[model samples]
Target: MGIMEILMIIIPTTLLWAAPLIFTALGGTFSERSGVVNIGLEGLMVIGAFTAIVFNLTFVDVFGAWTPWVSLLAAMAVGALFSLIHAVASITFRANQTVSGVAINLLAAGVALFLVKYIYGKGQTDIIQRGFSKIDIPILSDIPIIGPLFFSNTYYTSFVAIFFAVVAWYVIYKTKFGLRLRAVGEHPMAADTMGINVTKMRYYGVLISGALGGIGGGVYAQAISSDFGHATISGQGFMALAAMIFGKWHPLGAMGAAIFFGFAQSLSIIGSSLPFLENIPNVYLLIAPYVLTIIALTGFIGRADAPKASGVPYIKGSR
Candidate 1:
């Protein structure tokens, strides 16, 4: 393929793959920013995926093309509710945050599998009748090089993800709530003394994480997988966590990391078709994103420090 042709194919595909990661990584950013380590992001994603698929399948006829979009909202609600399990266990009871997060991952997977079997009498749900579709931006797609590379044949969800990332950045850096949230995460005792209601802020952080993570899962199912299955979510959530850490827990940074990972994933899926990549082993391509994730987390890409109080449970008056 010519260079332009290759660019056309790769850019759109990268956006498609990045959308879910952006959402999930942003979720992780929120939770971690509030002194909670959300190891259960994977579980939360699974719940969102399962819920989105089920909701889509059930209402496709009634809602028509809007089913997938509406299903995402449902996933958000379910994800937030499910995340309460971790919030209560870790925050309310002062349990080990990591253990609680792990429990959430396990519980979400088990519950989703059981419910799938019960609901469909099978290992996965039937594929949805309708899912997201690519479209060309009205005026933008008419531009020369930039148009086709960025605007043509793109999923609306991708744009939405980018928009949300910008919003996340604004919310985290330019808002009063953001300051309080950071205060609680960095030094809960001090924030509490300032009358910030450390517990309430933490809850808000986790809840936002859950809701955004749910949207990530729902986007993956509707725009990528088109169904709910045991393997549907797989390690996307973990990859998102990696993105968050890689991005140093900043929303825009997470979005950039997600896009990079998405590029790696897209190469894996489409490498064989490209002349340059055709000679590489398939295993290498498949493992590239994961390997990069490990490398990023291990500090090879510069140090990424988490919030000082992150993963530390806060007791009202305890030092």
Candidate 2:
């Protein structure tokens, strides 16, 4: 393909890959902003991916094209319910947040694999026949360079992810709920003194993390993996966490960071097909995203400011 053709291919692929990251990073934002450290995003994503794939396989015919979207809802619901474990352990019982999150990750992996073996008698679930396919936006896709690069032959989920990023930014910074959520994270005692239920805000934050993280997993399975297996989720959740921190925990910043990482991932996948990158070794390409993640965390952790009370369990009536 020519240069223009290559750009067209790479740009949309990057966005498609970035969609899941955006969703998961946004989930992290919600949780951390509300004084919760949700390291279990990975587990929630696995559950979401497994649940969505199972639902899609079971109800593909009945729901037709709507099956994937409905399956997304199923993922979100299960994700939220599973996140309650983390919430209760961290918020209700005041257990160590990191330990609770780690436990969640281990539990999700075990449960998903157990269900897979029980249901399929194998290590992986059956693939769905139909998934979210590429769609060219009407009128917009016809625009000259921008249209061909972005609007044409793109996954609808990518646009939805972008839209939600904007919505997340608005909800996190512009609304009353956002103010209270931030307050609870920064100074829960002060928030409680003002009659804001710190526990409730923290719960909402963690639940939002689960819901969005699940949706991210669902989208990834449908758009890329098309099946659920032990390796289906892999390290994308951690990558999302990295993106959240790299972006300074802001929604739009996370979106940008996700897109950058997604581009790196896409490069790894497509490097062999490109003219200049074709000469680079495949191994380096494969490890690029993870290496970038390490660099980003190490380079930015000192400068990036987390929520003041993140990972700190709240104690009522303790001044």
- Using lDDT as the measure, the top candidate is 1
Model 1 spans > 4 angstroms off? none
Residue clash pairs of candidate 1: none
TM-score of each: 0.97, 0.96
What range of 10 consecutive residues in model 2 has the weakest lDDT sum?
A: 293-302
Residue 68 lDDT in model 2?
Answer: 91
lDDT (Cα, tens digit) per residue for candidate 1, span 1-319: 7999999999999999999999999999999999999989999999999999999999889999899899999999999999988889989999999999999999999999999999999998998889898999999999999999999999999999999999999999999999999999999999999999999999999999999999999999999999898999989999899889888999999999999989988998998899899888878866776787678778898877999999999998799
* Candidate topping TM-score: 1
Local distance difference test, per candidate? 0.93, 0.92
Q: Which regions of candidate 2 deviate over 4 angstroms? A: 282-302
**Once model 1 is optimally superposed onto the true structure by TM-score, how far is the C-alpha of residue 294 displaced, in angstroms?**
3.7
TM-score, structure 2 vs. true: 0.96
- Listed per candidate, the RMSD to the true structure in angstroms reads 1.2, 1.6
Q: lDDT (0-100) at residue 185 of candidate 1?
A: 97
